[model samples]
Target: MSVNENLAFDALSDRVRRQILSILGEGGELTVTEIAESVDMVGRSTVSSHLRILRTSGVVNERRDGRRRYYSLDTEGSVRDAFLFLQTILRGGVHFDVEATKSADVAGEIQQDVS
Candidate 1:
């Protein structure tokens, strides 16, 4: 994998980081304290560490407002590229198990419905 791709995967491998992303994906930028509150079991410092990794991987963007730092998803970044790469491979007819695909499709549909 390319450097950005590898970084993206590495950053995403942690469950805490994934939770942080999901919190950021809620459409608005937030502070470390806010993210830590939303993400169970972790503190502000832990959230900040995850945010740092996400920023390095180009999966999230950080903004400074004087003393405060806010974070949001980076829509046009390595994470997006990595997903697009996987999508292209899937579209190229390399299929997984039909049952697994069906389950995933159903889960996606449910998520969309919730959204």
Candidate 2:
């Protein structure tokens, strides 16, 4: 797999990272304090680690404002590419009727009596 794909998947593998992404997805930029408070489990240092991974993964964009750094989603980043990959998987292969599977499942079931 490509570096971008690897980074995207690695960044997505952690619950903390996924939570951080969800918080950033809310819209505007947020500071480390805000992100930590939102996550409410990790410390500032831990959040910083997560932010560093996210930034390195190209999943988030950061900007310096005075003494604080603000973070937001990177629209054209690896995460977006990962999502597009999932979309491709969903659309690939021959089309099939899901209802047909239901009928097949019903036909394969064997009834049994239980006391």
Candidate 3:
């Protein structure tokens, strides 16, 4: 994997970071305070730290509006590239449909539960 992909994956390995990403995915651009409030347990400083990792990994974009800084997901960035790479590897270069993959995963989980 490339450096950007490695960083993206590393950044995503944390549960809090994933939660922050989910929040950003739904809310679009949000300030540090806003994100901290949305995310449980973590404070603004911790959220800022996670945001820094996300920014360095090219998974999130940061913009400053005077004293406040806003963060949002970078749609066409390393996270997307990393997932595409994973998809290619999993599909052995064949096409992979995200919705189908999700359904398969759910079915596999249900089968495991039933077993």
- Candidate 3 lDDT, tens digit per residue, 26-45? 99999999999999978889
Measured on C-alpha atoms, candidate 2 has an lDDT of 0.86
Instruction: Indicate which candidate wins on lDDT.
Output: 3
Looking at candidate 1, what is the lDDT of residue 3? Answer: 75
Using lDDT as the measure, name the better of candidate 1 and candidate 3: 3
Error of 1 at 66 (Å): 0.4
Tens digits of lDDT, candidate 1, 3-109: 77788888899999999998888847999888988989688888888899999899999999999999999989899878877788787465556767899999999
Candidate 1's TM-score: 0.77
lDDT of 2 by residue, 6-67 (tens): 78989999999999999999846999999998997788899999999999999999999899
* Candidate 1 Cα lDDT to native: 0.88
lDDT of 3 at 100: 74
Error of 2 at 20 (Å): 0.5
Reference-based lDDT, residue 38, model 3: 97
